[model samples]
Target: MTTTTRGTMHPRFDEILTPEAIAFVAKLDSAFAGRRAELLQTRRDRARRISAGENLDFRSDTRHIRADASWSVAAPGPGLRDRRCELISPATRSMGVHALTSGAQVWIADLEDATAPSWENVISAQVNLYDAVRGRLDETREDGSTITAEDSPTTIVVRPRGMHLCEKHISIDSRPISASLLDFGLYFFHNAQALIDGGRGPYFYLPKIESHEEARLWNDIFVMAQEELGIRRGTIRATVLVETITAAFEMDEILYELREHAAGLNAGRWDYIFSYIRTFAHRGDEFVLPDRDHITMTTPFMRAYTQLLVSTCHQRGAYAIGGPAAANPTRQDDEHRHRALALVRAEKEREAAEGFDGSWVAHPAVVQTCQEAYATVLGDNTCQRDFRHGPITAQDLVSLEGVPQTITLGGVRTNVSVALRYLASWVEGTGAVAIENLMEDAATVEISRAQLWQWLHHGSQLAEGPTVTRALLDRVIEEEMAVLTRNAPPERARHFEQARDVLTQTALGDYLPGFFTPYAYVRYLIDRPLRMDGPLSPDDLRQSEQVATPVTNGSAA
Candidate 1:
């Protein structure tokens, strides 16, 4: 296929969408687009097999890879040893500045779930990240003064959209390109050498990988990218999130696949839970999960997952990073703030004590607590890779037999409310929202909706005696919408309606869609004519209206 560098570009996108950057992205798309499509189809087939009652076990073919004791992942790259990482959306300039100055060791300049994926947002995030990489990020304060990063800034690790999402606005050969490549290619094209010059290479956090084959794909992309940019063989490093049930079973293989480029693996708790639910949604009451609130890391199943992660990473000589602490302190209430702090402290302490090298925090407030917890366990040590805690069996990993399984009316209502609010915010171009004090993102929303689907599908009996049927869910949705409509501003109320439609379709549909973004993207995020063809023809977007308008003050008008 001939490489075409022409596509619809947002007005604000011109700065980041340079001719050279466009060509580079086109090159990546031309090279890897076929593999990406095949992987996506493989995902569909795997999901079908699981739905047909096929048990998810470690692949027999890969037994040797898992059993081999001689293999280990590459050593941690620069600035990744002590990973007290904080996730921040790069779309927000002030947030980007705050993340750099917040003193966390690593800042996840997120372009995936934490972002709204608006064309404006997509370009703006790239611009912000570009500025951030060059140490040119500055935010004007209320006093008309500027705030900038200190002498020592946090290391930036970009998390592009997963393999499943597409950048519909950007096309190659009239087909939409992978969102992952668009993000990775553009960032690498512009910032790879600059990041290397600054002593840190182009680092990434690969999200939602279901198997080692996916890891191999990423590794291959890294190799091709490095070669294209004339970078050293191992200059690029990635930390894979073992967030899927299938991935949980293939940790060792995943690391082996990316050994040359792998820094470590993350225990992505929420998405892990969502994956479990989605994988077993067809299975009867046995796999029916309890409330999302009760599914803490200390729970038996969760404990098993994290323990296996720590053990697997250590055995493979990779850093074992723990999940995100999503608590955002509520300043209006002292007790609430204290409670939130206590919760974060306990969670971090648990991760540290359980032999994780480091953990993630969603807000800056928890950074110190995470650092202090790691300090207690690590002291001067970079990681606990020497700590071996498992010869854990497949039975142990999937043993949900005796875990807590109570469902409450409150839990159902919470799921509905949270999912509605989140979808509403998401469609309005806000991927992260503070819901009841917690910084909720796509993962949390996934759990909420997945749980709702599981409960309704299984006719789960709530503690209050009502079964979680579609009728019960509809009543609850109506009740929640009424309350939101009554109290919310008019613009927000409109968003609430949009959110309701999205949540209802995704949660109550006969079959769960692989992801909510694709459906919502076409409906809410794309303003142009829906062209289902090759590279978006110039004529396709010639008179296309902007799909995503700017949100003022994060409001959804």
Candidate 2:
């Protein structure tokens, strides 16, 4: 536990880096790494008070804990109330046995932005999520088929890696620890008592939250990791994506700062439209935004941010979910799989008629079209949290009124060819990349390099003419890197030249960096050195099997 710096450990990643999971990730980096560095310097002093123009309300010191009304939250745990969820990739052991047999009640797995944090994908995605939470996951098929999970029932959650990322190949006294407390302290110290004795427990999602004092520092690191793993104290539920525009103006104070480890709230729609273009990129042209394919989720500011996140998770009972139906299903084009299953069944029937209690599908051929569009609006309902639509104010969750500010030249050359082919499949380790058919990830390359730094800091014009300069986004990134070097393949030309130097240092920098995986994880996933047992080529086993299948339309060469 006190081992100050042991960076390269791969051979059986010491069976989930044991020494009591590196002393429960060094006691959650010595009890909350200085309140996670003062909530990341209060997120760089609220982005320099929104670049000095200031204006991001909600928090007259938590407004009597959001006007207290006999608080709620701790409920739906164990195989979390159904709707449908799927987003696999615990660095692929046959895509975590095909996303725990992809029927989809829940299967997140993730390890942040559908993975590629590479320290051998952060210790082989913690040994394939500790063999898929002890059902003893299995895999094989390159055609020789195998895959297991022995009678899978789904529900696994996980996600970890957001408190502005760290795990720089694990260190201690020398610093660098919190990759969200080393992926939720090694999956709640190897699956919290085998997922609460196998009836499902240790669930989570969290990801990029902005405030509610970073969900009260993850509810004081889940009440000091369930009182140092003696378990039973709201076992550990968590959901919280709410994906930033300052956590959509503090969703009920982030469910009243994780009310006993809350379990709901998602709609992390492409990192909440890349945190509303990196928190209004230098305040100009009324928060400029247009093409991330015309900002869908039926845009009037994404239907007032998914109807104020399903009326603040059904007025605080919780479970809202829905975002990410990143269309990936062109199985040999039956008219592009019925127009990507009728655009993911009209975005899962507008998140199952705006009371979302489940949604998210990045292919297992659209998880039964998002479980029959949430079973035709939740038939034997496991959610609608008693249908509360809202008294929704705060200017309907910061209304970027009537939002279709059309800036096009084919949406700035499809945001410089999908942020240079999803940062060349995230510097070749591949953190989700279907591409032209969607499923891009790292929140669609942080909304394609924060919409090319808010269209070159608001000079934005392009509906077929000009403007948008940083010398016209460096001449449309050298004409999309010469059409990705004449259609890729030469072992993916050094990950499209390290994704054109990480999309020209985070889309032509001069401010607005915030993240492109913490400077492309210390430059291209940890500057060289520790290879352990490297050898994966054949284009790193075909970008780790097209990051668990579904890459048809324009195969993202």
Candidate 3:
């Protein structure tokens, strides 16, 4: 097929609009069409109620709402996220119940990219994971003491096979299953509904999204599923994987289009990188240019792409989350583990600095790093102050005609004021509040308040508001105080002292020639050639203590 670029929609996609694609588009169109009139009426009614100063649940107030029933606690600081990075892994029949529930915020039991052959395996993995997470069965660890599978603290999110893996077209182990792609999504949606319903959190991650049309299609099916299953609307949310390059351009439109059903957008990096390669397959020299690690995201194109995603989500008031890099993280030693941890830590820090609220983690090890990075960067007290300004007027918070403009940092923005409230909660750790606004979700507001309170009671700072005095920013002065007071974590305390010394020295205006500063080190590393001769060795694997346990190929552990 000849490639043509016409307007915004790529022309190559025109010819490949097969029957499946057409059906997909029709499904989305039908969903919006069916709900359009009702949605408008609901919005009108909601506007009138808000105009009259009535408290409302934003989920119910919308024409359509998406997300599972599980509720999330909002954090301090506008746009601050709980560094609980999601841990996604494909559960195989061989993965013991214990392995599946190991430390992580959310364990995505995947059926799309992880599993190979067997519908039986799919069903088995699902039931096993559900049971494991529910603590119905117990499994022993290497220590001989039984690790009762009680309270698998990690949330279980499932991603059923996509059209690319439909049982009808591609047999699993050469046998056909009773379910198709649509049927599988619906089946799990129904089965998981009872156990996970109601403000707990969603358990679904929609994968391999290629276009806005695809998102629309899923929204339609989701609406139907809710109606048929008697599941409350807005009880289920989807994390759409924006893997294709095109989806990036149409992101804001897609999120706005499915605001009722979307939990947020996920940057599907692996598939996206693969898609990038496929799209420019002709560039063979660059194709073998380097493996993922060798390629620094600071590169011109990558920087633009990453920054674009950050800005786009911020502009629209929705959460702009970074995608997973899928680095192999099975190192067990502190130093090596720190290196792996450092890689992930660096990524999260970069994203946070770039203005992303949070990011995706492929392993359990990176969660602390993500959390710590956010804690260090945003600090406490970001959320305690009053941001609602003036009376909570309709014009200030909500827009009767359209959506609220997102909070902007420089040129970046977010989709809703709730995101701003979330950041506030992250910072102050307690007592931040959001005035009822048309675009603000009541749950979001409540969660933000709760999280802020939790943080203040437990955060690094005092219960009072943050005092960012000139004295506080001076590390040397603080270190001296800490040493005088003999604070805990002596090693860490010493490190701070050393950093303070460096800061003090730098302030002295003594320019030593030929010094390789930290900035220079970073630029040198960024400019260095990517080392992709082979995969990590055993020594490398044992370094990161918190990654998925010992590395294994596709084979069993």
Query: Which candidate leads in lDDT?
Result: 1
What is the lDDT for 191 in model 3?
Answer: 48
- lDDT of all predictions, in order shown? 0.81, 0.76, 0.41
Q: Per-residue lDDT tens digits of candidate 1, residues 260-376?
A: 999988998889999989988888798899998788788777888889899999998898999988888954388888888887888788788999988888888878887887887
Candidate 1 or 3, higher TM-score? 1
Residue 305 of model 1 has an lDDT of: 82
> How many pairs of residues collide in model 3?
56
**lDDT of candidate 3?**
0.41
lDDT, candidate 3, 109-158, per-residue tens? 66554443232344445455555545564655577866554655555566
Candidate that beats the other on TM-score, 1 or 2, i.e. the better one: 1
Which consecutive 10 residues in model 3 have the weakest lDDT in total?
Answer: 407-416
**Model 3 deviation from the true structure expressed as Cα RMSD, one decimal place:** 22.3
Off by over 4 Å in 3: 1-83, 92-103, 142-144, 168-190, 196-201, 282-294, 325-329, 332-334, 380-557
Lowest summed lDDT across 10 adjacent residues in model 1 is found at 548-557
Tell me the tens digit of each residue's lDDT in model 2 across 1-557: 24454567767888888888888788767666766666676788889888778877776877886688788788888788674565555456777787788778887888888787877887888888888888888887789878788768988888888887776666665456778788888878888898889898998889888888778778877877888878878889898888887887789888877878798888877788888788878886877887877777777766777787787777779988887777777644788878888878877877888788787787777788778877788877878887766565666665778777788877777777887788787778878878767676777777888887888877888778777888878887888789788956786877888788877877787777777776676667763762223322223211111212222211110
